[model samples]
Target: MTTPTTPPTAGGGRSEYLHGLDVLRVVASAAIVYTHLASWISGKNRSWPIGDLVNAVTSPLHLRPDLAFIGVASFLLVSGLVVTRVSLRESPGEFLRRRAVRVLPPLWAALILAFAVVSTGLVREMAPESAATALHLLNNAWFGPYFVGGAVLLPVVWTLLVQLAFYAFTALTIPLLRRWPWLPSAVAAALISVTTSLVPQGAVGPVRTVVAFLPIVFIGQLISLAQAGRVRLGAAVALGAVHLLLFVRADLVSRGIFTPGGGYHNVLLMIVLLVLLFMSANGPVARSRWTRALARRTYSVYLVHMPIGFAVLELLVDAIGASWALLISVLVIAVATELFYRAVERPLERLLRRRRRRRADLERPVDTDEPTPGGNRDGLAGRGADAGRSARQGADIA
Candidate 1:
């Protein structure tokens, strides 16, 4: 599908976006789900002392601050890497369509369902904010805490706005940064730090946190772009070390321990995870049918988890002890996710694909000299009579 306009530096591999990045999406989404489950079970508290007792009595430092902080950063890093691949070649129209298809419907469903299922007065609060919050424009009005219930997000979806911005920012700046990648990364980090410092802590803190988060997300993109591709061994060692350091030293910083932000240390951690994901995606580990299937339905899983998890948490609190609730909730979520995927996501995806094919056929180029809408043939990624000629004449980056 090479065309006359694609950037040669893009690696020009059609499977690059499809198989590589999809695998990482599967991995990152699963990690985020477990993290959310853990929070719900513990009533949003992770007692390190008790955690230490368990580590001493049972396994290793599983729920430690250092570990949790890095895990979250890893998610952001994965976001930066995959988003770069996605944004790099997408036309604005295609980008909007893909993003809307991937994010919106499930988000709407989750907002409604989570509000319906969660007791503890969550539904009461969401009842008033549901319509406005679903719009996302008004989500800032209630941002009492970064991941707190005041935000109308099903759970961690608010961070996705930062993700969305990162995608847009990267796309707009690609021509500029493709030549000097470090410039964008540095400025982005500086901006995030400056914005974070300006926001006074308290009621305004959560709302302001979104502003602070942008640069970090961009930083992740820059790090991936800078490496020029995969950064597995070097990135893994660097990230693993930095993540540990940030986890241990988070208390000294103002952004709070095990949370998304602190300073340079946290930003580095996020970048490292992103680089790691990029490297991993470049490999074949996550290209299996199971993982692809899992990635296809990740949006639904994300939406349903909060509301469903809340209901399960209520049940577990009354039945199982709070300590065990997180462990159990994740297992329950996996089963529910499978059902939701088969019942909801797959059917809609197939329908969309069919409609898209029909559109492509309708827009098929005539055999005459007039150009197509985008100045290319329809239905193909870019295939036509000119592909071989375009490839040889240094016109391959279409």
Candidate 2:
């Protein structure tokens, strides 16, 4: 999940950086990576020594490997809050542009990289005959696999499509949201509730998945609005309750569509715990250098860890033994994640920021020597500086 640079204050000024979110991001990413590698993958390849150990530890505890998707729940919450914060301060067009710039390039690059890796014959299981087809890559690149019946090269990317849908919804409803922060979410929750109830079982498929997960995002948005004092805390709580109910109902209706996990109740419990952590953890430890650094790399890590880690494990397991191979795979994932962040994500973000600044400069009026009858240039300059600060804070969320 992306961290906001700074949150806007209740009085429309900048607030302190939410260092706690960094802590949450670190936890969320670790949970996800660990779940996939230690639980999910190990369960699938039962021959691995690490799998045996993981199962031994987890089985007694009654932990389902799929319950690890609580990490995804955390991410959706963070994304909703961050995106809402950004949308509040930006024009719809600007908001969409920032989101696209933030999300798309890394995804496209990762898709290409995954395709290349699969083509290399390093991971034979992943390298299906269809893997070489350009259409398969295109399908994944466009998230057609999630919408249609097709293989997803990177399974985690299904969330990205959901995020993109949320972005579009937020952008479209920005005007209404600015006017009445609670209205859009309330209406959406009601609509989803009705749709989920009325629609025949299994008919909506992808649409059901999208709508089912949307309430989770809305809960995040409501939290943001409450924090910003745009909506009353009580009202936000009520709206969040409604959304949570809708989320549960919809998720239950489409139970078989997703990989069977800890059920909706378990997911809800995880979400509540994550939110509690977010609310309670905000001290120096959360603001530590290591936490912040790890937070920045979470998105990059989420993007590449799975496909790349699997490839490394599959390639090295026979030669190095399971324990050593697992260790090496993790090392490779870390290195690749860091490189991808430095080489792809960070640069694209900087380039977009530069382009945005240049466009803003070009759109500005020319400086003139003549002073207005009542307005002071100094006062105007001060206001402009304030706006710049707000814009910078807004960009942090994106």
Candidate 3:
């Protein structure tokens, strides 16, 4: 989640604005939608032509349709890039605050909607007993299945959990990032990442999952540094390549690594996807009003699309057939996302921003009543104005 702002350039130089990132957001959302849609279709009929087409196109390397995890990977890369940009301009508190405001409200709404769907038997992914746990619904707020035990309203929430963890980690280390740019921290993180992988995983499986993904997230941050010119492009690329290798190797070596269907092929696809995304952001895609308007709802689309889309699919698939049902589901998700954005997300974000601004204004220290040396009201150095006035007055007296 990134907020656009006028960022000061490196070494106090001119500003650099990243246009077309909204386009990337839209693409990432669409990729995610397609991924889930393909999965649904494949589940319905493994021999379906459309499902096969999706599998072929999406998983060029691994040949498994599940390689659509590329969408989530791209989203994470975009997030890392944007998060680093925002982090450079914001204090850690402000960074975390904005992240929460942007991410959480819509998420909570989606979780509730998901519960309603499951409760009504609109979707049968979760059992009634699972839904009845109630605390699982609340715990889904934190993506805490590891702590709360296996009850997730929407399975897509695992990505959000990874995202929030990244946000928390970035918020804590943002000061260090700003101070050292990317190289030193990345190197240290890479070392720790490798070391963590070597640690045998038995009881601490969740810890391994977190460690597994941290390197990928760091690759995102490195891309941001390169884009901002805070780090040399070549160096960033080299380090990224190393980190990528480490990630794949760790997965291969560590038995607990989560590669859904594709092995090293999925990892390769992610690398290519990140490269393409970086190139697209730098290209002449250009920011557009239409793209921005839709991109504003991408978060809503992401949060609710899977569960809601699947529910709509199941409801309509028998009546209209799977192909038509899938199209209808897409339309339904689009309309719902727009409504969620306008009715819930935009309003909540605005209210939070207003409140945050008021709080910040109140917390900001006012100029003290005390005067500076030589009688300035504020505690800033005098700029020879008092002496100039005295000289002019003396000349007039003379």
Candidate 4:
């Protein structure tokens, strides 16, 4: 869901990482990939043999095709928690810059690759005309499709757009967050609730989608703030509960009842499960080698899975049997995700780290006067040493 950021320390000044969240990311990525390839695609194309097979297998279990979207919710929660944790020590400008660097380049590269794949006619589901023009590609690349009424090049990018909006909200409200801690989330909840109620039924749009999702992210932030001792645990829990209720209300207002299964019941179920997981499972499970490896690439996998994996499945399914085709498609996804991570994600992350280091160095006060051996020349030198240590600490966590 999120790149590993420094986690809050436990009591007694002991620093600990929530490797469990990493494990959850890996699981969430797999769930979404499976949902798309097996559940969603199969549901869409009933004539396909894989569809029949998937339906036969899953129907008895009563699994909802869209249940895997809980993975997206998981990601949003993680983004809020991790991003807020980092933001505590970062200036708003630096936070936005770092977030842009971490998120955008890989997204653009994936869009380019998706455009190339679609142009090759490998993805039978997508019409060539949809992505035939450079302008259309640019629209999707820049996240203009949702606003401008064009098809999104990569459909999953809608979530990233929401994430970007949350980043802006976070940056702008950092001052309030630092002071009142819970005020921004409360205000966001109130605004979203009022806005959704005022809008006409079934008229949910991008604005509503973006606003509704903000509270979910804010829920994550409340948890992080509580962990960091910025907010009282009781207060954070109460605020988080209120935010979750408002989020559910927004969902109900915008989408109404979604289902063969009692209207987004699973959505609330999943969020509850995720919170429980975050509390109980945030530890040793992530220490596994394979788990860490998968977690590291989850973001890259999320970026490319649908666009690339679906194409592979469509291209190969007719030639091979459904099972083999699905297997191969998954393998292709794994390889492509790895490559994307190595080429785009990792490089940009290194650049971000370098930038942070440079900033820290620049911000560190320099002592022009020679110091006595093993001692400070003055209080300025001591202050400089403290500032440098603080900067380094911030960089490490960031």
lDDT of each: 0.48, 0.71, 0.63, 0.67
Structural similarity to truth (TM-score) of each candidate: 0.63, 0.83, 0.79, 0.81
User: Tens digit of lDDT per residue, candidate 4, span 319-341?
Assistant: 77557878888999999999998
Best by lDDT: 2
Residue-wise lDDT of candidate 3 within 100-215, one digit each (tens)? 87777778888888887777776665335357457778877777676546567877766666567777877788777767776544654666575665677554435566655656
Steric collisions counted per model: 6, 1, 0, 0
Could you say which candidate leads in TM-score? 2
Candidate 2 ranges with C-alpha deviation above 4 Å: 1-14, 44-63, 122-129, 261-264, 359-398
Q: Against the correct fold, how does model 1 do in TM-score?
A: 0.63
Which window of ten consecutive residues has the lowest lDDT sum in model 1? 389-398
lDDT of 1 by residue, 67-136 (tens): 2333345556556644554444445566556555655554555555554454244433223343334334
Question: Ten consecutive residues with minimal summed lDDT in candidate 3?
Answer: 389-398
What would the TM-score be for candidate 3 when compared with the true structure?
0.79
